[model samples]
Target: MEAPVSADKLRFLIYRFKERLWVKPLTFCLLSIAAVFFAKIIDGTPLAEHLPIIEQSSVETLLSIMASSMLVIATFSTGTMVNAYTSASNSSTPRSVSLIIADDVSQNALSTFVGAFIFSVVAITSLKNAFYGDAGVFMLFVLTCTVFAIVILTFIRWVDSIARLGRVGSTIQKVEDAAMKAIDHRLNNPRLGGFVQPNLTALKEQGAEPVYCEQTGYVQLVDMTKAQNWCEHHNACLHILVLPGDFVSPNNPVALIERTATNPTSNKASFESTEAAACEANDIIKVGHERSFEGDPRFGLIVLGEIAARALSPSVNDPGTAISIIGSYVRLFLCWAKKDEIRDKPTDEIVQFTRVSAPELNTKDMFNDAFSPIARDGANIIEVAIRMQKALQVIAKCENKDIQKYAQEQASIAYKKSMNTFQFEEDKGRLDETKWSD
Candidate 1:
């Protein structure tokens, strides 16, 4: 949940916007074109006079070589990226593919090569028109040399990054970093700096304006600021019905508006205002086909869990990856729980929390989302089950009761699933020997 799509307040939109495949390349293309314009403007300048001039044939040959090479490089990069995305979608969670494809190093490298190609093309086209004077040619020549150096450097880095792209551990780390940023934001603004939600009166059944969802999709974001300000303007309270990451249909309500205007008004006007507010609220709630990670920390957890699930599948059968993911899950939980502890502690710098009425991410939900699939897939494997148990036991030792409760609950489920999987007394006995409490 966040304010409307203002670049500063809408956290999720900012995250997605920055990672777009075109942002960097488009920017660099514009810069490259700007360079050509600057060269033309400075054609008679002293700066251009000091620049070295090359033969027209030499410039033409270089431009042709660069244009052709860059075209091939761009194609190769695109193909490689597609392969990486496909591999990540299959090997890791499908959700993870977004982050892998948006990686900075790869995107920048592609942008560099692509921009170089455009620069060469523009220069060659202008050359045919006889646009470049002696000074402009010298400037263009210097610029070409600079672009060449960048292409070489970027190609090296791009190769290094491609080698690790789509890897399970790398993808997991990326997901973890995203989750941590979201967790930090929540820890700072648990209520989104709004009023407490749990105690807020449920007015939807009591004549509140209903904001119906228009489509079936996950609730990606709710512009709480716009909604809150609108409600304030009308002397009403904006109540969010579904938080980000929750799936909804057209039948489901996204928010409920309770009219709290103290002035007695005609029923006709009141009804009109309430309906208008509902319409505006609907505009503020942004639903999308896929869940995003900006405000939804659970998305990261779910993705990491999916990675473990794939590893435990019979076809992939990689217990080591499962074990590694168990540790990762534990670390992720500790990060979340530790932040909760920090936020709860009283300090001079701490301000009173504005506890907005949104769904609290339950420890049980995290446990179920992260472990159930793994438990189901690795039921027959004792080693995986043991690692799962130990991972839970570690979290269970923490003082957080919800964490302990969830850890114990998943532990019981893991054991029960193993009960059916183990045919012999020895395997069953081995599982039973260790205790979640201990």
Candidate 2:
């Protein structure tokens, strides 16, 4: 949406002129000057006998030559300006109908026409003396040329503008089409299947195992024989989970698993102890609730799997982090509702989650520190961040209270976590300061 750069404007101007600036202007100027001097060449010679005709006509001829010179100058200037304007407009990629309409091709055309008309008038004036001082005819010639030039320029300008507009429109349509295709590709890709891919290679390298299921919900029991068979074929361990029908709370065991020991003899005792410890941990946090949903228990399993993914990789690169954050926030609200004995209450019975009056952080200091490196890299990151922050603030004020509250809470948590992690990494010399810049 921003205007084209100065360099582009200059380049456009130069390109439009091409070789015409020097060739046309120099040729016209020299011819005009020679015509003026030609009057002297005829003076006091055998041509003096014809001096009356030449002298009488010389003034008009001189005027005509001068006009020609002026026309050349004007035409060159107009061409350069038009080229610059056209190039600049093309680069901007206007999005609005109003902006598209405002692209002033008419102005450029008018300038070009005026320049060409001036040149035509100058050239015609030089020949006026030969017309035996017929002023009306000379005036007519000049007027006709001017009108013709104007008409031609106007037509050219309109055609160019329309063509440019069409090109821009076509480009935008193509981009939109490509974006839609990309969305479709992502949605339909079999490998992804609307589910996050487990990093099986990483898990294997780390000596951890992943479990997969097609049906919804957690497994209540694993047929050991079947599990072992599957594991042997896939070179993986079997993961088991208890279903919700089983009476289990956050304080009860939800699942048990057997892992291949790293050492057969010396680690057998340690491996048993480790497995027992893991089972105890799972028992402590198992959800204790009746299965309210009729079908697809895999939904709950997927949710739990996603949560585990987030626990493993708590960063922006991890897709699970955003989901986990939102889910956790929702869970927190649910816990609050339960504590207030409003868990079964209708929507109207719930208190409106209004936005809290909170103090704004002093962003000036943060911007100063954050953007210093950006500035060094020849950018205005602070300016951009400040603009974005201001826009967000305005949006928050206008948004629904619940939405605003959720956004604010999420932002605060993300920022805090990011700062804490950054500090920890920096202290541990794990962060490269050079990489952080820009």
Candidate 3:
């Protein structure tokens, strides 16, 4: 089924918002202020007489303690997060920093501390100003106690997570999880909910006009539903030329718009309509300065390869990390290969967007994006080479013929590279003997 354009936009917006460090803190701060004032609503209620009398001094002392302690904790937690981010960037690829920064537990812990501080300050100020009656004070006390309980729980959980937040293994795991998500989505919607792109030469020969964008950046998303709607209304078909992670500029066409029929001698009104539709086609595709993982499965694989390359560099001779990354590649490919098992038969005729054409992520491209760099960088390391060969052999056994072919091809390439670089004859012989069995 075709996903709505608004849904993609919304999900992307939410993802972008999550990457910002201040968003959660700001939201919590606002909610804290609201909570403090909400007690004022119960000031004149008849239940005030039944509510227990809470001493003002006790509340004042508790608020003071909370205000002071929370400020210190929030500042400390922020510094710790910054250090963890730096460690992740240094140990792994810098791209992994965003994943750590977007950690929900860390963000929630910081937000809670900040919110508690704000709540205490506001409550203290309101108490001094005599803003609350007996019942209101009691309600404020209850909220304050609940806030303390929450802070304690979040602190404990955050401490446990922060311990491994920036370690190399933790960073690699995060990247793998992200890659798994992207590959799964790609497998489920191979054509991104559109029909396979027809022949570009044929499309061009049929007078399909290219749609160019004014901005230069990577193509982050293509709104197929919008393109389908525009095509249906304008009596045209759209062929998307670029997928997510593809860099584009004004000189490069993002898609080709082909008209079903032409009226060369159309009136001025029709000409203006055609011009308007051409402009709308440009809006259907989204371009951004950076590649996003949401729409690009290959981006994750590329990042994982980068991490392994950095590990294999002379400064960081961590062959173990690189070998672990090889395992990750196999796991990701296995997840992708499960698509063949999911479908009982071929789905060549299953298409949701008849008017839109988009390309699918090719298996060769996936293997090249992920394994090529690792193979080139770690070719001489016997341990890394052996692991890569074994990983590929395991992948070659999967049911998907395309995956098997690519796996074998990558294995052969890695083997040749290792053979040329190995210092000893024994190492080469050992690698040669590690081939996939029949």
Candidate 4:
């Protein structure tokens, strides 16, 4: 006959143990069952006879099973506690003392006790069956493995953080000033100007042997007899000095028909007698002259050159300007390629011709032409131009207003010069190889 009070107290304690932290206990039970099943599968083999004596005996086997169960429970509880701490730290909510106390009572203290007890049971069980029967050695091995795994994971995370930090830093750094100067210098070169076909017969008769000059403002005219005859008959020597491929500045000399002593003298009496014939010849010459005058240099070049100049200028560090300039150039090139004169020429031919004639041009394949001077100098120019633009954009962001304004003006001038030169080339029929080359 147990006392009524004692029996009631015992029942209450049992109920409380079953209900308190029910989820964690249930999880432990499930893990234990899984471990038991795995052990049974491994031990039930035909080679069980050769198994260790401690593993064969029921008491030792049970201890080994308990050891595995304890290890799992300890690992699970430690991981859960770590996760909780991390989550709480990262949360945006304000921390309260009461909430912290409650968490410690319900989760930290209780869970740790449960986990540690399970691990102790498993460790003891494993030690009982271990070959050397050295519990300390087995325990040490388990601890070492756990620590090593944790260290490896932590190291990986640290490496990832470092990589992310590097990328962010680079993204925030400002642009350079030397880059802008280089870009402006390339874009504003006078060699990027337009072309003009000269009177070939007049030049030939004047004992002017065509001399190949390096950046001397003279581009050799090939197969331009038709254009030359027309200009000669019109009594106007075509301006070959301002050839479609040459870059021109306001200071560049204009092409003019100089009357040398070699030109035939006009006999007034003979001119009157054959006035209609002379007039007809003059008209033919005028038509030819008009045909030889191709309108506007390469629009693509003008737009791109201006963009490069502006982008590289120390006054403006705007990425929008670079993008805008690039976009405009792309559109203009596409449009120009579709024109009557350019339509028939291969893409390679057009690129080569433009690149060869204009050393400062920076578009892809600008130097494809064997005859283009750009092949020799274009890549260096382009690389420097790009660097300069980046540099200017960087410097502009940090510079004073007065300096910025001055830089802006300089950029504007360079841009205008580039555009003017490009336009001059486009107008002279350089964009269309058939019109100019033939």
Q: Any runs in candidate 3 off by more than 4 Å, and if so which?
A: 1-5, 261-275, 341-350
Sort by lDDT, best first: 3, 1, 2, 4
Please tell me which predicted candidate would have the highest TM-score against the true structure: 3
Candidate 1 structure, TM-score to reference: 0.88
In model 4, where do residues sit more than 4 Å from their true spots?
Answer: 1-239, 243-295, 298-300, 307-309, 312-315, 339-438
Name the 10 consecutive residues with the lowest summed lDDT in model 4.
284-293
Q: Candidates' lDDT values, in order?
A: 0.77, 0.34, 0.87, 0.33
Task: Give one digit per residue, the lDDT tens place, for model 1 in 1-438.
Answer: 234455324566667766688988998899988887776876767776676777766777888899999989998998998899998898888889888877989889888988989999998898779888887777777788888899999999899889989888788788888877766766665544445454435464577766788789987776666665565555666667776788988887777767665776533234455466667668777788999887877788788788888888889888888788888788877776675575565542232322223445566787788898889988899898888888888888777777877888999999899988999888888888764654
lDDT of 4 by residue, 1-438 (tens): 111232223432443354345555456545533443334444445654554443224444444444555456446545654444444333211121112222323343334334434543554454456523323333334443453343345435533532322121211110111122222322332222213224556665774322222233322122223323433443333333433334433344323333223345742222222333223222211111111111212322432343344434556434444444333333333332233343245555433222112222322332111102111222123333333333333333432443244334433333333334443444323222211110
Give me the overall lDDT of model 2.
Answer: 0.34
Give candidates' CA RMSD values in order.
Answer: 3.6, 27.3, 3.1, 32.2
Residue 195 of model 2, lDDT score: 17
Mark the 10 consecutive residues where model 2 has the least summed lDDT.
Answer: 352-361
Model 1 residue runs over 4 Å out of place are 1-10, 18-20, 51-56, 198-207, 261-271, 345-356
TM-scores, all candidates, are 0.88, 0.21, 0.94, 0.21
After aligning candidate 3 to the native by TM-score, how far in Å is the CA of 188 from where it should be?
A: 2.0
lDDT (tens digit, per residue) of candidate 3 on 60-147: 8888999999999999999999999999998897888888988999999999999999999999999999999988999999899999
